[model samples]
Target: QLERGNLRTSWRKEHGHLRRAPVRASPLWNAKQRSVAAMRARVSRRPHRPSAKPKPAVSPLMLALVCCLCLFPPCLIWLLWRPSLGQRSWFRSPSPLPPPSPLAPLGEGNWTSALFLGDSSFVAAVHAAGHAFDAELVDERRPPLLVTVAEKADSPLLQNFLQSSILKHELRHWLVVALDSGVCEDLPDDVQWMACVSVPAQQEPADTAEPAMARPVNVKAQVLWATVKLGYDSLLVDTDVAFLQNPLPVLADYDRAHQQVRCGSAGAEPFLPHYPWLGAHVAESASTCESVIDLQAQRDEEHGIGAGFMRVKATPGGLLLLSRAMALSLKAPELTLQQSVSQAVGQLRGVITANTLPPATFPSRLVHLARPSRVFAYHQPCPKCVVVHSSWLTGHAAKVWRMKDQMLWSLDGPKKYYSDPKRKYIEYSNPSSMASQEAELNALKAAFMLGAMLDRTVILPEFRCHRCPTADGKGTTPKCSDMVTRCSLGAFGQLDLAKFAGAIPEDLFRERMFRYNPLTPKSAWGGSLFDSPVHLSFDSGKGGIGSLQASPEPGWEIQSSRAPEILSGAEVHPDNVLTPAADGSPTEDEVVAWFGSQTAPVLRFEHLYGLRPQFRHPARASAFDAMWNRATGM
Candidate 1:
């Protein structure tokens, strides 16, 4: 009270006579204060300002909401501008590798050793190729290429170094680390894929969704790991590849070794099957003949083939480095980390310096299995090539070196090496785009099949197959018989499935189905059922599944909605099985990848023989019946 009294007296003393002049207030301050008071008054009246543009008389709750909305615009723009730094990265540090140790004695200065490392699991193929060149399989305890797999899947470097066609380490002291591709790597991209009964093109089943899953047990990482662990040296080889003679006598010149690679050959598709047995690969002495069907072992042993031969000179330090790489790839938490392994080995020095004087087999060196009698025979009794790879265009590889014969080049000349005929804004030259197309094709096929099985229709934009056969006389013949043509499905509409059967690759489906499926029509099963035997040039055997005199009717509706697991095998008798679609596995991605890549038209010849219902398109009755009548020629 005293303080108030003192303030009142001071005011009275200063303004008692100040009333002579009227105090004029500025509109700016008064307006601001009034506005502020008005704002405050809003809370006492109503929470929202009905006159404000955005109804701004905000409540504590509404103010918070407006702040969030204003903030979102900038946040979303930032996200759009940024790239995922390590989102899909395959890079890793150097794998933990064993010390490089020599398998052969340097006492014989430069006397090199060659080892074949690949999916050469077939005992017959191994023995036939080994004995053919008087070569021996180094099954003795030795280290394989280093690798790791934290998650069960092949890393990038594993595919390029071991599962790919290029023989990066074709060493004199060779070591082959063979493994199954299906078990080692995710054969198909796991994303943008589905596993379900019905997948409508527009939307998918919401309640049950599973990630696209593919498991890879990398061959390179495993081999590198084995090499480090075993402490031995060897030359690596793919079971699908072959040699004219034992490379033992061929390692005289370089600091290391040299083997031919069909640079222009068709890149081996990762999903293809390979030699399928591990037990007798060495002691049996495989390379005795041309075709190695006898090594016909169980189906599970080799899910896919290794890329080809890689020559490694048995340097004491080399194995150590590889072992280190292997360690990084195969460690418990992360197995088959290929990028790390590759970075380590890529540190090794070398380049492709072709020998001035080439070998005879090289005159027509690498012959890719364009045809699907597809069992590869390594170093047949007398090898014709210094080396051969599993590349699809291997048949044309020799043409690159054959300066004498411009005629040797086949149609499939430019693989990853050459550019397609130019057209503005075309995608063949775009690796990134190509990958996307392949992904979409695989996704579409998967969706279509799943939808069909569930008696539903799936809409998909039309696309191209993985490969396409050359137009008649459309491609050049640089080699004797190899050929290729542009096959990106987007460029060309639906492929002539019959024409593309060879180039698109038939084994992914055929081998998977016929490996031990006694019910499959043997002769035409590996090849296209629609293709005539006379046109097939890869057969060294009595062409066709001649044994399929009578095939059983695989009981299923012409357009029945059923699970693949429902399909039973013929061996069990149609009446006594768990399902009708036993041939198809748990996921359809692999099947679709194979199907999408078909360069040929798909003709379920089994339908023609009345071995099964004629319809394959099960989405619509009208479509299925029309196809049935067409196939039956009704």
Candidate 2:
């Protein structure tokens, strides 16, 4: 008969949640009943052999000891054999593949790695890149490839990226925060690791102190070296770079060939050779090969690699190249990071197999969004370009504004048309082409619309007399006679009057005016036509009689004279020179006729506003006043 404890245990194993059932109706109970009846029947039918004195009932303790003896050896063997079985190759379950690393996952679809330095300015660039990425892939449903952005520990920019919606939406990933423990302290929770970099102390020249620009290069180099050591194929991107497409696919060819370093060009052309110039045998003794090549001479002949955007594999060779480059940067503090890296690559050409993206492919592949003049000379705008670096226009807001204007003009269908009626429109119907066109148009419209509104409403010029002489009498006093000359009319003739008549948005025109203003603060002005100073002097010998000088500040100086000088080549009116009314006031007809001869009077109006007194020539000024009042209601 089964022990109650054993029965309960067996029942529990089979159906742990169930309560024990009564044994009376069980099969085991029926079998026990039958066996007892059979034993009694056998005793009744046969003469019982004199039963030996009934064995003394086995003591419970003795029974238990016997049970232990039988089970112990097998249990012991099982304990030993089980572990041995686990150790055996055939018996053991396959060890589970290690949990994928969060930092660097290895797979065909694994995240693309990108590194950036600095904060606010770069953060803006990253945001711009994100925008471009969104625009480029709006219709596609593919998962966002992870992009790792690395910044200095305790960088405000890092905090911004962590808290930004850009990362939350899977558009970007904050993979690491690189720090120099000596220079910075405090690590945030969001990043996967704090990359500790040791920056060498700045060794300044005895003749002059170290340049401020050199410090960033040092920090960037050290961070890059540390990243490579950590086993990441890193793409070091400047804060000024924006992405229009995924650049990772472009590196596939190089990655497949096991190339250690792949660099983009600063100009339109690639600097490195097509195939490995040095064989494997030659690279083994790279130091000897370096001595044979004149790197400086090669750099002069070839377009140098752009350091702004470069990809370095995490292999030993890549790490060594980065280390060499970092050391070079520290040694040559005078050179830019790009120059230093170019020199390093040139020096180590034979030691390292590097590839450069072809120059012709640069525009269709990666564009350097530098100054328009610089970029336009080399980069041809197209839909296929993946990256843009706006670093060249960094602090120059005016240049940036002008770039926006150029983009708007490019997008504006009206502006693109030729005089030929046959070629009135360029139609693009392909989805990708349409998407790009729409994106550029949207960006242009978004950038300009707000400015257009403000220009039309808020920034109307207040027509107070800039030429009103102060009580000190130090500056020129405005006179009505100044307006009567043909020289003044000629100056007025040069102005674009339609610009102020709503042909150009007031804000844009104001920006243009402010750019022309010598006294306008560069920080305050949004744009400028002349990047540098332009000297202009009046020639009294010609039809021009006014003496004007640009101040170091934004305002201009016009020499006022009571007796207006008669210019030698001044165009004379056939009817009358002055054409003044009996009341010494210029008639409406005379004012109208004078202004009608002018082409665009916007600049001329500004000039007149600056040169004339507030109450000077009430009748003659009425036309301007009416126009200004009608447009601005001021």
Candidate 3:
């Protein structure tokens, strides 16, 4: 109450009011009075002191001097170690490799190795020719040379390679290294080739009971190393590979990218270093190089990069890598070429780097054969592939047949034999179902015999199989993993049907039946039997079992719905009759007398299931047996 009264007096004095009107002692007025009294009491208790003078500001020079004093030791230490500071990179890039020395002329140094023996001059001349031919390409983007080593046994394959290159206009850039005289003779006179006797001619001496020096499982590396060291980059390919396109342009891109790649950069992701097959290749893809599985000696070793297709540069690293590989191959003769190269790469991992060609564009057999599509026919799974290495599949015959089916074959010099107008053909369909491969083969034997007897080329049907047969059909049976689920004629029996008995390729039916064939007019084809000539239906009497009479009485009949039109035409003759025989072989003269008078270009057999024609003559019987073996290999 006293505090409120004092506050009310102070307020009245401040307002200068003489009359003391009733003033409200609100909470705000009482609080202000207490704060004023507290301040007055604090002031009353304080001791009195004189004010001190302000100190002067420190100079900029003094401030800088103090900072220097604090940092002197560290700065001195840094200055003393300044030389080593620049060597450490903050961004973590790879250490730059020493620049390679300029390539010298071939014979300048001790270029001869154990593999090459002493063929320095010969190799130098070969490289000079290669450089000259590459210069003729006029395109600087192309690789320096494309090379392959071949012997007499690989003549067909060499022919195939040459033919493919000629088609793609890449023949001029090729440099074939011949391993023997036979290969040299097989090569065209105009082709750029050289004979290298680096490998031993004879494996063993006749007098020695002991084994001889084990020859290299593959001499591809030695040839490649010898050629690359001759001062030019080279693309080494196997003879079995079919060049679908000029691979030099694609390989040149790889080479350029490889040249620009650093040891540890984002640009190196798409590229692989030299000799990539250090261990087993896992999860193969479009960009990866394939590893060859060596099955020799039942080893089944799946190591080493495929030597079939390699793009080697002439850098010091490249030379060193090939050198080590050649040395390893020489030391370990039992190792396959792929295995030797792989071992070398494993040893020289840090010393050198190489680039692997993308297997998608340069496919091996493993990549291509695994495709569900018809790879050999339509170039499926890799139509844009530059080169298709048809390795892994054994035998030259298999390679030849596959290439022919793909229409990449020029062994016959680009002639379309399947569509020849002068040729007369016999067509037949496969049985509705076959119990086994043997059953189908028996049917094939019947067709082949009929073709030989009638002197007409038999058209093959799509041969179905549970598993792909071995290339020659005489090797080990294929595993279940090699089974192609669809109708594949490649798995069919590989025989010289053309030589033993007249036969055409499966191109007729493979290219959408006879419609795609040029010999058969497109307008005449109405998707009926009428599209062809007379459709002869043989009658085996009751129960589909009876002996065919030599005379033309109900032996055969025209089964086509268009039989009237066919009969109206003069193409069919009365003697053009044949029937399935139950017993007894027909004489050659009687058989000819029965069906030799027909003038039709295409003989359509409705169903030749039970038709088994046999000759009575001993000579003819012997010939037929030989033909049978060639057809079915039974």
Q: For each candidate, what is the lDDT? A: 0.29, 0.35, 0.50
Candidate 2 deviant stretches above 4 angstroms? 1-171, 174-214, 253-303, 363-380, 391-399, 406-634
TM-score top scorer: 3
> Which ten residues in a row are the worst by lDDT in model 3?
291-300
Among these predictions, the greatest lDDT belongs to 3
Q: TM-score ranking from best to worst? A: 3, 2, 1
By summed lDDT, the worst window of 10 consecutive residues in model 2 runs over 424-433
**lDDT tens per residue, model 1, 1-634:** 6896687678879889756444466889789989999988877886554564554566889888999999988866665543332212243222222333324322212211211222234222222222211122222222222122222122222333232222333422222222333423332333111110111112111221211111133334334323332343334443334343344434332211111111112343212122122222322322322111111111111212122334332344445444444334333324333344344444432311111123233221222222221222211222334544433332222212121111111212123111121110100011121223334443334333343433222322223223333332123232223221222222233323333333322212221112112221223323345532111122223323342222222321122233222222212223222222433232333333323443221212111011122134345545644543442223
For candidate 2, the lDDT comes to 0.35
Poorly placed runs, candidate 1 (over 4 Å): 1-219, 225-231, 236-308, 313-315, 327-342, 346-634
In the range 210-262, model 2's lDDT, one tens digit per residue, is 35323755556544544444443456654333444455554443333322322
Q: Across residues 1-634, which tens digit of lDDT does each residue of candidate 3 receive?
A: 8998898779877987567776577899899999999999999999997898775598778999999999988876675554334224342222332222334433223432433424565455454445442223322332355777777788878876776665446455466666667676666665543322324443322222222123424456656666666655666767887777776555544434333342235534435454243112321211223211111011112554666776666666666667676556555667777777677666765454543445556556655554433433432434466777776665676566566555456553334444444455555544334324554555556656666667766665555454553443334344434433333345554444333323333322222123222233223222334334322222322211132112112223223232333223323333244432433234456556765764455555533343345765679778767655654456
RMSD of 1: 27.3
Ordered list by lDDT, greatest first: 3, 2, 1
